[model samples]
Target: MSIINQMLKDIDKRDKPQFGANRPKSVYLGRPLRTRRLRLILWGGVFALLAFLALSWLHERLSAPASDARPSAEQLQIQRVPVLISEPTQDAASQRADAETADASTRAEGEPEETRPRTTRGEQATVVVTDLEPTQTRAEQPVEPVEVAVSEQVQVPAQTSMPVVTPADTTVTASDDPGEMSIQRSGNGVGSADRLFQRGMDALSAGHNRNAVQRFREALLVNPDHIGSIEQLAAIQFSRGFAGEALQLLRDALERNPGASDLLLLKARIYERIDEPRAALDLLRGRQFRLPQDADLLILQGAAATELEEYTLAIASYRQLVSWRSDQGNWWLALGFSLERSGDPLNMQEAAEAYRRALQDRSLSESARNFALDRREALGY
Candidate 1:
């Protein structure tokens, strides 16, 4: 078996050529070579693109039109509104300059500058605004109205600085508030009086009652018909515990300006302040003092009448007041208060209704709401 294997080995070696020598493998590249040629090709592509772009830009610039800049006439325009002469010239500035030069020469010669305008051969006269003329404005100047308020506390009335000549019939109107009075003005010596009145108001607003009274009196002295001064002075007097003086001042004003609602309101307020409800009622009811239905007056009447135990009058006044301004919670409460006191049994139902309405008012004070609730429960409504 060994001899046969040796023989087979010899035959295999003889059949195949000897394996000692080697032939170089056909030259082969390993991985693809990274060469500078590739870099050169990339750089050439970029340079060609840049050259094409530069050529395109130069061509566009050369082909574009040249813009010619002509001078604009707008450069010579002075303003939208021109000052025209009686005979307008093409050169307005030159014409104005010549006029100014002529005026200077006339002044130098001490000649009265011609008052009349120099007329042209064919042109009509033009009214041009000169430096001496006032600025153009509306011809009529409306007087600032004096507004008086005495609802919660005494507020100083508005005053103006204008000197207006009082018309024979100066109209009086109610201002925006029912508590306010606006007097249309036409007056004389308006300067002194208006200034003094304004100063007095400032002083009063600053809590200087004495100084306010003094200023208000001075205003009255300057113009006795100064209603603001009179009213403010009277209010100060009354607030300072001078009831008689306040009443006397109002009385004198009422004598001059009869049926003045503002004056009447102030006077009635003073009377009420002094606890003279009957006097206040009389003043309000007087034929001479009758005024258009006023909320302040009506409320004053209700309060005064209620204090006097005149429930019927109070109920009437409160009803009217509520009718005019139902949202006023205090007015509703006043209506209920007066109704409860009214002797008529039929009024109880209405009184309870008023109480319920008072409770419905959000503006009603906490104390007032509680009172309304208790009264409503007690009345079984």
Candidate 2:
């Protein structure tokens, strides 16, 4: 500090008194910068920038494999399908001996209970890493075992080397593969209706009418269109004096199968017994067109028409019956009986001719022949 002060005093003394305004002014000129020093600073900044970029690149490369090796927790959860994992098969005696030995060792060595592997009843699954690049860095390899312990998991039977069996009566399956599950009912269309029908028949033959009824009803439940089952059930109902119930049963069946011949005939008989002959006629009106050769339907239709004094309809039915079965004396007698009651002189003449045909039938009963003979005598033929 004293040296700088001495220099300053020497300069002050040399500037002895400048009393004149003509003293030269010290003009300011900027000092030039040192290019060498500036070059060194700029090179230092470039090296620092390059070093930063290289460090960042190395960091990203090191972290890439770690990211690829360990999947996210959410990904692992989604990939895990709950399944039962079975332990090795060990005999009971050997397992108990090993367990006792482990307990003794644990007690002697003061081993913590928690340090031993646990036996969990919870369902487990095996996770296998897949779909990775061939190259793997040692640092990226897993340091711990991949063991997932989920509290809530689906429980299933632990499978061994056994074939998987599908559920019963569940033949339906689905897949994205073509030519699989081609038809919905491809595997299960054979029902038990026939078997049930046979069971019902056995019961009926054994005089177990009530049991037979129940069996037939069960068969009908499985297959509503089971003709044999419905027929038997209807017969049982009508015979048991449940004419109304039988009628209802038959009507429900007819609703599904309007042209079912056996069901229609049974329904007509029920209607007649319940004093609904008009309903019977209406039910059987157009049925003849479809079942012209049905003998039971024709006989029932004829009887219903006669009860309602629909002699014309009755005569038509009997005429068709006689045409199909010329030797049926009852059918011939029915034709003559319907013709005589038609209240037409021309019909009376036809009645005599029909009665003559009835007498010619050897199959006619004694009473039926006598009735035909009296009708012919009264017709004055």
Per lDDT, the best of the predicted structures is 2
Clash count, predicted structure 1: 5
TM-score of 1: 0.49
* Residue range 179-292, candidate 2, lDDT tens digits: 123223323322566667899899999999888888887787667788888888888988988887787888888888887888887787777877889998998886544345
Tens-digit lDDT track for model 1 on 1-381?
999999999998876665433433444343235456677889999999999999999987876644323323322211111222221111344434445544554464453335423222232222333222222221122212221222222222334344464543254555433423445555466776888899999998998888888999888887898888988888777777888998998999999997577888899988887778899987876333122446677778778888889888888888877776677778788888888888788888888889887877898889999998888888898
Which residue pairs in model 1 clash with each other? 164-187, 165-186, 165-187, 166-186, 166-187
Best prediction by TM-score:
2
lDDT scores of the candidates, listed in order? 0.67, 0.69
C-alpha positional error of residue 169 in candidate 2 after TM-score superposition, expressed in Å: 5.0
